[model samples]
Target: MIEYHSLREASPEQTIAWMEVLAENLRPSDLDEIAATSDMDPLLSLTTSVMLSDMAWVITSNDIPVAVFGCAPAGPAGSGLVWMMGTPLMDERRTAISIARSTVPYLRQMHQRYACLWNHIDARNEKSMKWLRWSGFRLLEAVPDYGREGRLFFIFARYDPDV
Candidate 1:
C-alpha cells in the first residue's frame, strides 16, 4: 500500500538519507555534473521541508519512500509548477504508476485555484516520461535551451478546467 503524508512523520536524518538514495538513483552522485550543465535549483531539502511543513507531497510504500513531488504555487491566479519528483524505490513500472496516480489527488487538493499545472520535464528522463503519461500529464512543448546549461526540456501540463 502507498501512503501520502508529511515529512515530519519521518526524522530529519531519514529525510537526508532519502536524499542520499535519490542522488544515487538519479545520478550516481553526479548532480555536480548535471548542475554544471544546467540551472539546478537543487532545493529539495528546503523544498521537502516546505512540503512537509506545507507545499509538497511525499509518497511511500511499506514505509519506504517511492517518490516525492512539490511545486511553487501558480501565482495569484494561475496554476503552479510541478517542481520535482525524487527517486523511485524500484524499477518496477507498476509501482511507479501506482505511486503517481495516488499523488494527483493530493495535488488537486493542495492547489484548487490552478486550471493548469506545468513542469520543465528533463529531456533525458525517458523512464519518467513514460510513467508521467500514465499519471495524467501531457507533453505541451519542447522548450529548447530552457535550462541554465542550454539543454532542452519538455514543458508538460495537466489540467481540469472544471476543477
Candidate 2:
C-alpha cells in the first residue's frame, strides 16, 4: 500500500536525498536557488527556518521511499505548486492515479481564487503532459523559458470535475 508521508521536519539526510533527485531535473538557474550538495547548510537553514510555507511529501511502501512530491499547503486540492516529481524507483509500484488524485482537494478549494492551479511540464516531457491530462487538468498554454535554452514548458491547470 502506498502512503503519504509528510516531511515537515526533514532530516539533513532526507533533505539532501530529495535535493539530489530534484536537482537532476532542474534548470541551471533553478539550481542556483539552493545550495549545492557539498554546501547544504543554506538549504537546511532555509528549509527549517520556516515551516516550509507549503508542504513536501514522499510516497513510500515496504519501508522504502519511492517518489517525492511537494506543493503549497493551503487552499483547495491541486492549488499549490508541485515543486518536483520523480519516476518511482520501484518496478511494480505505479502511483499515477494516486499521485494525480492527491491534488483533488486542493484544486476544489482554490478554484475560485485563481483561474486554476497551474504546473509546468518540460517540452520534452510528453509522458508528464499526458499524465496530467489523464488526471483531468487541461492544457492552458506553452510558456517559453526566458532564462534557459530549449526549456519550453506546457502549463497545465486543474479543473473541477463535479461541474
Candidate 3:
C-alpha cells in the first residue's frame, strides 16, 4: 500500500539509502549543490531543516521509501516553496500521476497562507519542468549559473494574491 510516512519514523541508515535513491535522479545542478562532496548531506539537511518549519512526508509503497515531499517558507514572509524527490520505481508513470493528484489539496492549503508558491528546477531537467507546468506552476525566468557548478535553473511560480 502507498502511504505517507513521517521523517521521524525513519532510521539514519534508511534515510541515507533514500538519499542515495534521490541522488540517482538529480540533475548536474543538484550534484553540484554539495560541491560533490557527498550525496547524503544535502538531502539530509533539507529533510531535517524542513521538519521544523513545514510539513515533511515520506511516500512509501509497501513500506519502502519511494519519495519525499514537503513545503517550506521561501524566506519572504508570505512566500513558500514546495518540493519533491523520488527514487526510481518499476512503474513510475502511475506513481507520478498519483503523486501529482494527491498533492494538489495540500498545495491549495499552502496557498491559503503563502501568497506565492514556487520552485527552482534545474533547467536541464525537462521532465520536471514539464511536470511543474502541468501542475500549474508558471515559468518565470531562467537563472544562469544558479548552483554550485554554474548550472542553470528555471524559476516556476504559482500565485494567489487574494491569499
Candidate 4:
C-alpha cells in the first residue's frame, strides 16, 4: 500500500533506510543537480532539504520510502521554492503516473498561503521539465551557468495572484 506521511513523522530508522535507498538509487539528474549545488553527500542533502522545508512529505510504498518532497518560503513574501527527490522505485510506470497526477493537488495544498511556487530544474532533466509543464508550471528562462558546477538550469513557476 502507498502512504503519505508528514516528514516530521518519519522515525530515525526509517530515515536511515530511506537514505540508503536514495543514495543507491537517486536518478542521475538529481545526483548531478545536488553535486552541482552542494558538497553534502546524498544522505546529508536529503536530511537537510527535509529539515529546511516548511512543509514536506514522504511517500512510502509498503513501508519503503519512494520519495520526499516539499517547499520552503523564498525571498519576497508569499513566494515558495519547491523541490522533490526520489528513489528509483518512483519510476515504476503506474507509480510514476500516480505521482504525476497527485503533484498538482499537493502543490495546491502547499501553496495555500503563497502567491507563487517556483524552482529551478536541471536542464538535462527533460522528464522533470515535461512533468512540471504538465502540472501547470511555466518555464521562465534557462540559466546557462547555474549552481556550483555551472550546469544549465531552467526556472519554472506557477502563479496564483488571488492567493
Pick by TM-score: which candidate is best? 4
Q: lDDT (CA) for every model shown?
A: 0.61, 0.52, 0.67, 0.83
lDDT of 4 by residue, 35-117 (tens): 98878888889888877888888887788778888898986899998888887777788887888887777888877978899
lDDT of 2 by residue, 1-163 (tens): 6665667677867766754554354433333423321244433523442235355666655544545555554455435444444533422325656656665554454444444456566656555666667667777887776123445666677754444
Q: What count of clashes does model 4 give?
A: 0
| Residue-wise C-alpha lDDT for candidate 1, range 39-151, written one tens digit per residue | 54444443443454335656667767656656666544567666545554534666766766666676676457566777666677777677668767899899887656766
TM-score of each: 0.71, 0.57, 0.75, 0.91
Error of 4 at 45 (Å): 1.0
Better of 1 and 3 by lDDT: 3
lDDT of 3 by residue, 1-163 (tens): 6676656576767766765665565444444444432344656645554464466667777766666767788768888887765666413788777776776776787788888888777776666666678778999998887755576777889888889
**What are the RMSD figures for all models against the true structure?**
3.9, 6.6, 3.8, 1.6
Arrange candidates by lDDT, descending: 4, 3, 1, 2
lDDT assessment of candidate 2:
0.52
Candidate 2 stretches with Cα past 4 Å from truth are 9-53, 73-79, 88-93, 97-115, 145-147, 159-163
Candidate 4 has its poorest 10 consecutive residues by lDDT at 14-23
